[model samples]
Target chain A: MILTVTLNAALDITYHVPRLQPHTTHRVGEVVERPGGKGLNVARVLAALGHDTVATGLVGGRTGEALRAHLAAAAPGVVDALVPVGGETRRTIAVVDGESGDATMFNEPGPTVSAQEWAHFQDAYRELLIDAHVVALCGSLPPGLPVGSYAELVRTARSAGVHVLLDTSGEPLRRGIAARPDVIKPNAEELARLTGLTEPLRAAHEARRRGAYAVVASNGPQGLLAVTDEGTWRAAPPARFEGNPTGAGDAAVAGLLSALVEGLPWPERLARAAALSAATVLAPAAGEFDGAAYERLLPQIDTLP
Target chain B: MILTVTLNAALDITYHVPRLQPHTTHRVGEVVERPGGKGLNVARVLAALGHDTVATGLVGGRTGEALRAHLAAAAPGVVDALVPVGGETRRTIAVVDGESGDATMFNEPGPTVSAQEWAHFQDAYRELLIDAHVVALCGSLPPGLPVGSYAELVRTARSAGVHVLLDTSGEPLRRGIAARPDVIKPNAEELARLTGLTEPLRAAHEARRRGAYAVVASNGPQGLLAVTDEGTWRAAPPARFEGNPTGAGDAAVAGLLSALVEGLPWPERLARAAALSAATVLAPAAGEFDGAAYERLLPQIDTLP
Candidate 1:
């Protein structure tokens, strides 16, 4: 089983407006809602790709109930092990303008996890890890949890003999990498922030040297660059797909994990990650990839050493 | 007892952001949620002013549950007679810019109400009206409900010998006015839309001639103008108070209804309404009046024939 943890899960709502004007009233059309957070997004894609996935996190209040209900109805394949907490789960709204096709996002700071809840989550994480082959610690820590929350999870996964993938930014990411997780997936900007290098190859190398076993840097339309102990490779799609790029990184993480579990070579794993990431851009909704696009793009992806 | 009907109730969410920019992500600060609709706002104000207020309307799903929970916790003074339905209630978000102090609003189109649910609501409305002295039909009709929903409610209240106040806009307001409710409150724009007269006094008179027993026009900053069978009056505050005008009209409606229940004369009713409306503007949150300001401004309000 593949386990994914989202410390701060959200009920993602998308409001479609004809045109967005600042400080004016808008009658929104088509309100679309889904369960969201980086780990959950990755778990969703993995489930869609025919992998056994379990999701764990802290959720509370009515908003938390709503998120759980959505997950049960929409992603039945992914198992729910989310624990209850005190505060209401926060909501993230994307106001998508129909005219300009631009989305203005407003993210509410998530519910604060109590000290008791954090201790309880650590116990639950260990229990879930008992049956898992791989685990992905994803997204930011909700307030009240220590900044080393992801680092703690990484250590737990390592002790359980599970290959953990750390996907987060800022202090959590900085601290988590020191635990020497199997893989760290950071986009180009995040890579620059961590390693202070503009070039992707050098940045990934620097990140690995800082204790990440492998570094997978997503370069938006350009695709994935990987620096692993086995080898270094660059994977690029034949064409750039134009659509919403909201959950492309999560798709890449799912692809990399799936390929790793299948015991594929480094080149094949990089190719799969690049194809899934690009296909996700073509898909209309977040956390979903176009299967047909993925199939076509996969065979044509150029992986160079 | 005063009964307020919110046919389309909402979970009003306010997000405070440092600044609002088009197509950019905002980390929102201070998320505030309240149960809202025009009638609900009036009911809250009436309860705050020590009146026995009952709020009735359609609510459903998880969002409805959240709204009810909030109403229970916050407005314990107001009685809850909200009827349950199958569809989820909607949410309206106000993104307030901290820098400019301007709010950008986004309203979700409420859940589609089945005909069976509409029939159930009418039954509930009639049952509640039996012990009520006054009923205020407020706000827009949700999808799948008849356009003349308010008209039906007006007739039901009138048949129960209950004084009815119609507070809505466009076609619902037009159809509701024909039911000959005891009072109809319209802002300057709503009055113009109803009577095709730009002038407030003329529009108020025209609206009364159409079917309302009395017409109260809320003129922003300038205050209240009333055209009734017994008399015509204009009520204005000593000075214009600057703040949010979101629920000013609802405060005016609450003041008028409270005064009517007390058997106050038309001039006194207009004065109370104007003072409450101005105080509401000075209050930080919607549907709340600054008590100190209301008391100071009430004695200074100038009412002229």
Candidate 2:
């Protein structure tokens, strides 16, 4: 079982408009709503790829209810989310122009989680991690939560003999890496912010020295770079494609966690992660990956040091 | 008794931010949620002013539930909204910059009202208008409904011996006036759009000549103009004050309906409407009129031919 923790969940709403002109009225052509947040996105992709996953987070208000309902309707058996009370879940509105494929996003500041809500979430997470083979901490912390919240959670999961993966940015990532999670996934920008290094290889190495067993840095179309205890390796997809790249990082996290749970070798995990991420960019909507595309690209993905 | 109908009601969400920069993330300082839609706004102001009013509209999904909860919590015993199945009510996000008093509004396309939902709403509106002295058909029509939807509604209320006030725009206003509603309130822009006359007096006169008993055209800080069978007049507020002007038009409609329900003279009704509209602009948030400010301005409002 894979347990993914999304501390700040969101009700992601995508509105298809012909075009977006700021400060003007627009008539949306279509609206699609889904449950969102980094951890939830990774969990959803894993579930869609035939992995059993449980998503836990603090959810409140009507937006939270809508998020849970959307998740249930999307993947009933594979996805289970625990909702906590206090503030309404935040919402992210993406105004996508179907013709141009450009998107303008307006994100609402999600509800602030009270002290009691964080305690409740931690308790639920501890219980869920008991049976989990792999645990992933994803996304930003809600307000009122200590910056070291992810670090504390990672340490707890490790104590329970669970393989933990940390994927975040800024201070949380810096603090969580110090606790030495088994794996950390950071995009190039976040990697730079964390290690103060522009070169991908140097930054990955710096991250590994800080206690991460493996540091995977995604460089968009340039593919994935992993610095592990074994050695540094680069994996690239067989071809480049164009589509919505919003959730590609989450797809990579899902791929890595799924392979780790299945006991795949480091090289195989890196290849699979790159393949899944490339396939995700080909999907029409955000956070959705094409399983058939992943299958087609798997054998051709190139992993090189 | 006043009954207000909002065919496309909304969960109005206002996010207070210091300033708005396109494509950048902002941490909102405050968030306020209210039950909105022109008719709903009108009803809220009427209830605050001590009028007996009922607000009916088409509501669905979780957003609809939240709208009802907000109305119930804010102005208890004043809201009686009828819910219809099929589509969730829409949400309007107002990104307000407090310093500049400017708001960037993103209005969601409201729920598509199926034929069944429209039938249900019509039945509810008829029942609510039975004992009502004035029936206000306000705001835009939901998708899938004809442009003359408000016209049909106004005719229905008039047939039941209820004085109908139509407040909408474009085709709805153009057709609704032909139904000979007792009163029609269109802002300067809407009036120009309806009559193709940029001159306010000419627009109001043309609207009244087109079967409407009276035409009330609100001209923002310039105040209001009215052309009635009895006479034609313009009313200006004593002073111009700066605040959110989002719902001032709806507040004017509420003031007009309040005086009409009390059998006040047309000039008095027009004066109250202008005063309340300005008072609404003085309120910190949209859809609320400051009672003290309204009272202060009422006595000083000037009416001219």
Candidate 3:
């Protein structure tokens, strides 16, 4: 079983408008709502790929209850989530202009979690990790949570003899790396922020040297770069494609975790990650990967040193 | 008892951002969610003004559930809403820039009410009008509802010996007025659309001539004009105020209904409406009126023949 954690989950709402004008009223043509957050997205893709996954997060209020109900109805047996009490779940509204393919996002700062909520989440995480083969701590920390919250979870998972993956940014990533998780996935900008290196290759190397066992740097359409103890490798898509780019990084993380849990070689894992990300971009909706596209792109992905 | 009917109810979401730029992501500084629709807004104000009001509407899905829960928590014993089986409630997002006092609104097309949903809502409306002194049919009709939806509701309320106030636009307003509603409130644009007269006095007269007992036309900061069988009067605020004006129109309707339920004369009702509207414009949040400001402005509002 693979475990994923999202401390600040959101109910993502996408609204399609002809155009967005500031200080004016717009009639939205369409609206789509879904359960969202980095960890939830990763866990969804993993479940779709036939992996056993349990998603644990701090959820609250009516929005949290709705999110849980939606996940239960949509994913059923695959998604197991633990909800906490208190502030309502956060929301992310994406105002998409379909004609222009431009999206404006409004993200809410989710509820503040109390110390008791953190302890409750920790207990649930420990219980989830007991039967987990690999654990991924993902997304931003909610307000009132300590900066090293992810680091504490990583240490707990490591002590339980489980491989841990840390995917976050800024201070959380900075503090979490000290716990030496087995894998850390950071995009190009986040990698630059962590290592203070503008160059991708140098940044990947720097990140690995800073206590991460293996550093995976996702460079958008360019593909994935992995710096592992075995060696460094770069994977690229066979071809460039045009489509929605949101959630491609999370798909790559899901692919990497799926292969790693199955004991695949590092090179194979990189190829799978690149292929999965390419497929995700090809999918019409955000955070959804086309399985057929993934299957076709897998053999075509090129891994090089 | 005052009964308010919302054909299209929405979960109103307000996000505070420093500035709004098209096609960019913004981290909202603050967020507020409330049960909203024109009738719901009127009902809330009436409840706050110490009136016994019930809000009936077509609510569904998780958003509908959230709307009901929010109303229950915020203003318990104020709303008696009916939940439909299909289609989630719509949402309206207002991006507010506090510095400029400007808001960009994105309104979703509410759920398509099936025939069954309409029937269910009509039954709920009949039950709510049992002890109601006035019934307000507010906002636009949802999809799949006929254009004469408001007219049917007005006729039903009249048959039950309840005075109906019709507040809407286009075909719904045209058809609703033909049923001889007690009152019709239209903004400058809607009045122009209904009467094809750019002049406010001419539009109000034309609306009153078209079977409505009283026609109230709200002309923004200039205040209100009313044409009734008794006489014609224009009510103006003492001064222009600056604030969020999203729900001022609804507040005006609330004041008009409140005055009418208390058996005030037509000129006094128009004065109260104008004063309440000005007070709403002075309030910081939408759908809220400053009680002190309203009281102070009440005596200052002047009506001229």
Arrange candidates by DockQ, descending. 1, 3, 2
Which scores greater on DockQ, model 2 or model 3? 3
C-alpha lDDT score of every prediction, in listed order: 0.92, 0.86, 0.89
| Candidate 2 local lDDT, B1-305, one digit each (tens) | 88998889999988777766654556666778998889888988899989998999888888888888888887775767666768888888777776776666677888888887788888888888878999888999888788989888988998999999999988988999999999998889989988899998888888888989998888889898888989888999877777878789998999899999888998899999998999889987677888899999999999887
- Model 2 interface Cα RMSD in Å: 2.4
Model 2 C-alpha lDDT per residue in residues A189-300, reported as the tens digit of each score: 9999899999989999999999898999999988999898888889999777888788999999999999988999888999999999988999876788988999999898
How high is the lDDT of residue B215 in model 2?
89
Task: Flag the better candidate by DockQ, 1 or 2.
Answer: 1
Model 2 chain A weakest lDDT span, ten residues long: A19-28
lDDT of candidate 1 over B1-305, digit per residue (tens): 99999989999999999999999999987899999889889998899999999999989889999999999888999999999989889999999899998889999999899999999889989899999999998999888998888888889888899999999999999999999999999999999999999998888988988899999998899888989999899999999787988899999999999999999999999999999999999997776889999999999999999
Q: What is the lDDT of candidate 3?
A: 0.89
Evaluate residue A107 in candidate 1 and report its C-alpha lDDT on the 0 to 100 scale: 96
DockQ of 2: 0.51
Candidate 2, A253: how far from true, in Å?
0.8
Q: Write the per-residue lDDT of candidate 1 for residues A119-234, one digit (tens) a residue.
A: 99999999999999899988888988999889889998998999999999999999999988999999999999998999989999999999999999999999889999999999
Q: Which stretches of candidate 1 lie over 4 Å from their true place?
A: none
CAPRI category for model 1: high
lDDT order of candidates, top first:
1, 3, 2
Q: Indicate the TM-score of model 3.
A: 0.97
The pairs that clash in candidate 3 are: none
Q: Return the top candidate by DockQ.
A: 1
